[model samples]
Each structure stands twice: as C-alpha cells, then as structure tokens.
Target chain A: MRLRNGPAASVRYEGILRICAIGLAVFSLLSWLLLGANRGWTKTTRTRWQKDPVTEIEGPLIEKAFLPGVDLLAVGLSGALILFVVSLLVTKNKTNSNQVNSSS
Target chain B: MKNKFVAALGFIALAATAFAAPLEFDFKDPKGVNNVIFKTDAPLESINGTATGISGNVTFDPDNPGAVKGKIVVQSASLHLGNPMQKEHLHSDKWLDVTRYPEITFEVESAKNVKTEGNVTTADVGGKMSLHGATKPITVPVKMTFLKDKLKARTGKEGDLLVIRANFKIRRSDFRINPGQMEDKVSDDIELNLSIAGAAPRG
Candidate 1:
C-alpha cells in the first residue's frame, strides 16, 4: 500500500481489538465494584443491632451510571469478553488450518 | 394469720401478671410519618426531610414504664433531599456512604430512672443505636404518653397507643461520617430526635 511509517495493516487491527478488550475489562470491573450493595441500610453503635428497611441514599455517578440494574451491564461486558476470546480462537484455528493445507 | 398470708400471695401474683403483660404494634399505618431535621453551619440553612419505609414495634407494660422495650429500623437509602447536589455529597464516601451501609437500627435493651407525670411518662431508656457503621450503647431520655383512655379514643379502637419522643446528640466523628475540615461546615455533634407512634392491646 501507500502507508509511510505506520505498522502493518493486520497489526493495526489486532492492536485495536486489544485496546477494546482492555477498555471493556476496566469498565466491567469498575461497574461491579461500584454497585456495592443493591439495597438495605442499618445504623449501629458499639453495642446493638439496628435492622431497618432500605432507605434511598444518594448514589455517586459511578453508582448512578452503572448500578442497581448493573446485572445487565455485567452481562454485556462478559459477552464482549467472550467475543474477544472467540476471535482469538478463530485466528488460531485458521493459522493451523493454513499450515495443514500447505503441508498437504 | 394463715388466711392473711394467702391473700397477700394472691395480691402479689395479680400484680406480677399485670406487670408482665406486653403491648406491641407495628409502624405500618399508612398515615404514620417519621421525620428528621438537622442544621448546618450559619451560612447554610437547616434541612428537613420526611423519613419513609419505616417499620418497627414497641413492647412494654403501662403498669411498669421501666420494663418498656423495643427496636425500630429505618432504611438509609430513603433519605431524600430535594436538591440534587447536596444529596449527592451527603451520601458520598466522605459523608454517609450509604452504599456501604444500608440501614440504621435502634434497639431498646433496658430502661432506668422511670418516672411519670400525668399522662406523660419519662424514663432513661437504655439502648444500643447503630448509625453509619458504629454501634454504641447510650441511655436516651424518653417521654411517652401512657394513658389508655386517651389513646383508645384517638385510635378509635380499644387498643393502647403510646407516643414516644427522644432527643439526643451524636458525634459524627465517632461513626467516621466526615472528619477534619468537613466537620467545620457540618457540626460534629448532629442532633437526632425520634418520635414513635406505637400501639398494642391494653394489658
């Protein structure tokens, strides 16, 4: 092609996929950690049990953006991770198939 | 003399039965409400909000105010401040961190120095209260209405209704709500007052 100093085209595509996977991993982890407890609250002192209903507390942006219904978000992240792994497997399978074909 | 002793024993047994009878009810009345009010520094106005999702019970004897005991639990996530930004900070990690802790509970283990005047009775209700994350034992001065006739008329039922109110101050630092400079804007000593509308069958 007419590329000046850029890396090979296939290498660029692989790099993009790697970056995407890393980003999704971070997003998924942060969302899971931030979800914390879905509901319920208790106030306690040094000596007693104070069990009560779940009162609405102000949640942070991380919580507001990713929690409560975060199970869906987690599922989406897992799907993306699975796709990444699948792609890797397909690439490996194709390489093996090509090697066998060449040998034949 | 033997007859007199038997009569004395019968009277003592009757008193024990009266003293042991328990009055119990839930805070499930739709019309019932719980509210908490707190004041900030001079520049900031005091804040008040309605407490929802409240459910608890009280069990005690009118014949003996000192034997009264119960516990109530309030959900932390239900705290609502009309303003958006203020609510955010108040529940953040620096303040309440409601995400970390979801409920605030208070249990009455005992009562002491019980005294009554007219329909209003006062007692040193000793209990363990848990807020934020720390649990502490404190003796709260409680005032309650102990009149069966008045409560019976109000509830439109023959059951007993008791109205209890307790006021106390707690140090925020003790629970790690906000420490250091944050304490300046919001006082370390946060005032908490609880007024409970509880009821049960007459003993």
Candidate 2:
C-alpha cells in the first residue's frame, strides 16, 4: 500500500514533532534543575554584583560550564538539544502546509 | 653652637624623608604563592583558575601610605586552568592569544579617598589595567597594612613590608573578550582578588 500525503497522515506526523519539541524543552529544564542541584549548587541564586571568591571554579583565563553532576559533555548535549528543537519546528511547519493543501 | 645643631637636625630630617619615600619591589620567585584569581558563577558549575608568573612591583610608602604607585603583571602563558586542553583553549588565538598578548598588567597610578584605621588603611585606588590586549582605567577599593603591623603582630622590630589586599570587578565585555558571543555562559563581570604581601622601604 502507498503512504498517502493525506490530512490525517500529515497531522499524525506533525503530532510526533510537536511532542518531541515539548519533550526536549522539558528535558533541558529538568536537567538544569536536577543536574544543577546534583552538583552542589545552593538553593539561593547569585548575581554578578555580589563578590564571589576568586579561588572558586571559574578562573581568569578559562570558563567551562557543566550541569552539577554532568561535566563538559553536558555542553555538547545541550547543543544537540537546541538543534533538535529547531528541526522539529521546521518539520512541523512543513507538515502544517501539507495538511492545508490536502484539505483544500 | 645652637644654630649648628638646628642645621644638623634639618639635614637628618631630609635624609629620613628621602629614605622613607616609596621603594620598589620585584616579584618573588615561584610567583604562584601570590597570584591573580578569577571566578565565574555559571548556571552549570563555577569555573575558576589562577595565573602565575606574577611579576611587577609597587612603590609603597610606609611613612605616607597614600603615596603609592606600581604595576602588577600576570603572564598569560603561565595561567594554570587545571586542564591542559582547557588552558590551551583559553590561551588560543580566539581567546587571550598568549603569543600575541602574553601579559595582563595592572598599573596603579595613584591612590584616592585614603583613610586609615589603626594599622589598617583603606583607599580608593586609581589604576589602568590591561587584559586580553585591551587597557582601561579602573579605580578599585583597596585595604592596605604597613609591614610594621606584621612587626607588631610578632612583637619584633619594624622592617620593610607592605600588604595590599585589593578585590575588584571588571566586565569581560569591557576588554572585548568574546564580546560577540551574547549567549556565553560565563559571567560578564569578572571578580579580581589580589593579595600582595611584600616588603617596602622605610626610613
């Protein structure tokens, strides 16, 4: 049987992309919270104005960030997450147009 | 005879003042003991490091603490970031470019808003600090203690030691360090904490 580009089929495909986007967003937020909490991050928030010890993690010449328990690899994963969200957006828009055309 | 005594006293007074004037200091060996420290509080984890090879001197006055001037320099290549690759990335051409700009210098031009409390004196210090190949005028709040305080602490004879504890903040954007990366994770304002305890000239 042929996979038809019908309105119903397009909606189903778009549903998957929409769900993926939401799932990725939720994952990032949760990682930021749970991972941040895991790495000994305090409950209080810190701003730039308050003076933190110079001896703490970030030094003069280098700056590397990771979620609490996760190390540098977390940065690469975050980048991938961003790409996934962008891809989902593009695919969903394409699916929407396809549905409109088939319905018309 | 009385006139002669007064002239003799005047000569000694001049000599003492000259001796009490600012004396310069050279950086100590293995400069890692006293160095430049920087820290950033990111959402993920805090990143920190220290740059050694700290070289420079201060012309500090024990007699008149307000009259002080000097510059401290941190060798870029000597920075210890705890990771060889991370250190390399920081010193790379994109960042500090250790080859092109090998040093970050903080020149203390003068001191202002000077006030003293017992053995401790605090001042608003004016200086020009250059970082990442960019130089800017900066005034930092500093607390100073004459070496004599050390002598007092030890109940020993007062010698030539001056302690300067200066903590200040500068925006990384001010020096154009990856300024275009608006989404950078590092904090824009960088905290600089310097503790320099060494000798000075005292008449």
Candidate 3:
C-alpha cells in the first residue's frame, strides 16, 4: 500500500504526539496519587504497629528507601508533556501555513 | 507551694529527656537487610536495581520534635539487578554509567514528629534526594522504634522488608536517557521502590 503524503503525514504525526502528551499527563497524575496513597498507608501501618501489641511473626516485609531526586523526575515528565504538545502545535501551524501558501 | 513549683519544672525536664531517641545504621549486612532498592518505569529492557554498601548516621529526638539529623549514601556502582547482561547494560553509558556517577546521597532537611503511639514514633522526614546527578526535595514517612540499643524502622510497606520503602514514578528522559531509535520498546514512566535497614547506634 502507498503511504499518504504531506497533510496526511502531518496529521498522523500530530495525533501521535497528542496521544503521547495525554499519556504522560495521566502517568504523572497517577504517580502523584500513588505516592500520596503510600504515605497514607505508612501512617496507618505505624498506628497499627504501635496499637496492636502482638507477636512479631514477620507478617510481610516492609520496604523503605529514598529515591534521590525524584521530584526532578516529576518536573521532567511535565516538561516532556509540554514539549510534545508544543511540537504538535508547531507542526500543525506549519502545515496550515503551507496549505494556505499553496492555495494562494 | 514552693515544692509544687519545683515538681512541675522537674516533670517538664523529665518528659523532654524521655522523648529523645537517636539511632545509627550500618549497611554491612548480607541478608539484603540494608540494601536500597530503586525503580524506574522506563521501558528499557532494564531500568531498576538495588544499591548496597550503605553507611550513614541518623540522630533523632522524638520528644523535642525538632532534633533529627542524619546522612546516608549508597555506592552507585553497587546497584545490581536481575541478570548479568542487564547489569552490564545498565552500567554502560546508556543508564547509570557507574564509572562516572558512583554514589547516591541523601541529606536530612528536617524531621518532625507527626504522631507518636507508645514506643513507636512516626516522623515526616523531609530532605533532598540525589541520584545520578540530579537532586530533588522529598518527604518520607519514617516510623521508628527504639529497642534497647537497636532501632528498627518501617517505611513504605508493600509486603516488603521495613526500613525504607518509596514508590515514585520517574521519566528516564529527564535524566537524558531518551529512547532514541527504540522508543516503543522502552517506557518513559518508571516506578521506584526502596527498602533499607540501618544498624543501631553504639553508646
């Protein structure tokens, strides 16, 4: 099959970028929620550890380690989303300009 | 009347002393007790690993609610993962580049006692997390217990060992680990989990 040219290609590119942008946004939001939720879980666990004075039977192992510079990851993801959107907009604008120029 | 005043002052001082609890950690244990785990969602064949050879100090006084101080560091090159091929790939120029960036460090900002129930005290420890070459501010919920000379801590528990547990998603692109030709195979969002244990302090 022959591939579409000019406007078609641009359209496909824009669509891919838009999808990527949305995906990144959703991923970032979910990350924030998970972190917050984990914090809540930690609080509850601490309460349980203190209140329920039971035997230390090694129920389930608890993992606690810091991810150095994680905030940068969040910020960087945000930036990537922004860049993806901007590129799509710029590509669409250029496509429109080319179409107008050709028509004129 | 005079005796009552002195008794009240003494009570306050005693309460303050009872609240102070400081502990140190040694990471020489081979049971994976002191290892630090880090995760990233980048869809690369391998982007997650564990860091061992940890050595640090943590001094915390829960009673005062403001005297918490500590520093921890993990040798960056010590990070190990599932397979040998993956390990070599990670240490290569594509990811950690272990030869260049050798250590991940954390500097304590402030530790505040959020809630205390009996012997267990939960504190919100805010500080800077540095990895690769970037540093960011992060707040970790640290639950600690003072047992004689040994101190045990539980953080971010998801059916894992207690000491430190963190779950945060990161983008590999941020650290300049872009998916150039094989973008589809590798994901940009990476989820991280960390579990660490520290040794108790000595007199």
Candidate 4:
C-alpha cells in the first residue's frame, strides 16, 4: 500500500507539530517558574541568605539549589521554534506536490 | 633620679613585650560558615562562585595591628558555581586546573595604614597570593574584628573569635587563567570578597 501524501497527511503532520510546539512552550514555562524563574543562567543549587547574629555577618548558605534557570526557557523556546518551522515546511511541500500532481 | 628613670624604662619595655605577643587564630572553621565569593562579570556572561574549603592561621596582635602576619588558603576544588556544568568547567584544566593546583593561598607579609577603632582593626595587608600556577603580590584592604571570648555563642566552645573581612580584585590573566581568550564570556578581572571567622580557643 502507498503512504498517504495529500492534504489529509499534511493536516495531520501540521497538527502534530503544533501540539509538540505548544507542549515544549508549556514545559519551558512551567519548569522555569517552578525553578524560581531565575533571570540569569541555570543553577543547580539554590542559596538562602542568612545572617549570623553573633558575628553580624550576612552570607548565602546553600538551600535546595538543584533547580534549573533561564536555560530551561531557552531550550524549550528553541525546540518550539524548530517545530513551528518544520510545520511551515511541511505545508509548503504539500502545496507544491498537489500543484505538480494537478498539472500532470 | 637615675634609678627612677631606669625603672620607668623597664616598665615601658614590659608593656611593649605584652603588646608584641600575638594571638594565633586558627581559621579552620568546623562550622562551615566561612566563605570566599569570587565573581566575574563580562559583556556576554557573568559568573559567581563561592569557596568554603578555607583553612589557615593568622597571628594578629590587637595592640599592634601593623605587625599582623598570617596565611589564608582556599581549596581550589571547593570553588563552586550554581551551575554544575559551569562549575565543572571552572575546575577543569582549561580553567582553574584544580587537580594541578589544589590550593589558592595568600600569605601575609606586612600591613600598612593600620587603623584601630573599638574592636575593629582595618589595614592594607600586603600578601603574596598564589593562584592557578602564578604567584602575585597583592594588597587587600582588610577589616578584622577581635571578639574576645565570644566563640561560645556560635560553636558552644569557650574561645575567642576573629572575624575577618576583605574585598579585593585580581586579574585572571595575571594568574594565567585562559589568558586573552573568552574575554567576552569571562571577564579578566575577578572580584573577590572574603568573610571568615577564626576561632582561638583558650585553655
């Protein structure tokens, strides 16, 4: 049997790509927010600033720092962009193929 | 008159001897509260890390602040960034080379412009700092507070506490750290802030 290569197949591919793009974007946002939405680079450790009452010195002590930072956002956004671009290419290829078939 | 002058001179000599005696402060804090923060800010990227593996001894005379002498050493491998990958890179051969040079040290040779107010003594400490593989003479402005018999409050031990604070800047290239490369990502100037409390327990 021949594989489907028309409007139906194109629509299916577009739907899958759109879903993947949305999923990646959502994942990135959720992960970034969960990881404290750090504006700087990704950090594996988090710190809590504390002051020693006796010495009166303030410093950061490591808290639960195993959290990702803006790097997660970058990765997720980049993945979404690639998927969106692929979807556009798929639509263009389907239109071209249909045009060629009709001309024959 | 001569006997009176000789007795006065002897009293002055005794007072000077008492002032010259230094208290040795051991900086190997078991509480893990001591830390040195190192920061690099470049046009493209800024990095911050902390080193907690600090140990050394400093001979500080509160009565004679200008005669201070000591060595402070930080473990190279103890330097850590928030990012694990970046931390690994920092400890790698191309960066700090932690395996080759395990200790970053600053040995104090002299102090200048020493000033004392209350329990705090501030001075420009001249020291030879050995980092990466090169040793450079650097002068760091240090403020030290000698808390007499206050170690019990922090560690539940009867001792004296010496709180030291210093802020200094160093050129990474001077220490041969990736000289002339990745300047956009890693700044050549490394800003360091050291805050440590040394305990000298009395018998």
Q: Which tens-of-lDDT digit does each residue in B1-203 have in candidate 2?
A: 99999999999999998766566654442323455677766554466666657778887766676887888888888765554555677789877888999889989988999988776789999999898889999999998766553432322344455566788898878898887463245677778777655543233
Candidate 2 CAPRI category: incorrect
> Global lDDT of each model?
0.61, 0.64, 0.55, 0.89
Off by more than 4 A, model 3: A1-104, B1-32, B42-48, B64-66, B151-162, B179-183
Q: Model 1, range B8-36, lDDT digits (tens) per residue?
A: 99999999896667678665444334444
* Candidate 4: RMSD to truth: 3.6
Model 4 misplaced regions, further than 4 Å: A1-5, A97-104, B1-20
Tell me the lDDT of model 3 at B7: 100
Residue-level lDDT tens digits of model 4 in A1-104: 12266777887898899899999989899988976788888886886667787877666687656576777789989999999898888888778777878999
**Candidate 4 residue-pair clash tally:** 3
Return the TM-score for each candidate structure.
0.56, 0.60, 0.50, 0.89
lDDT of 4 by residue, B58-137 (tens): 98887887888999999999898888889889999999999999999999999999999999999999999999989999
User: What fraction of the true interface contacts does model 2 reproduce?
Assistant: 0.03
What's candidate 2's DockQ score?
0.04
lDDT accuracy of residue B31 in candidate 4:
69
Pick the TM-score winner.
4
> Judged by lDDT, which candidate is best?
4
* Lowest summed lDDT window (length 10), candidate 2 chain B: B149-158
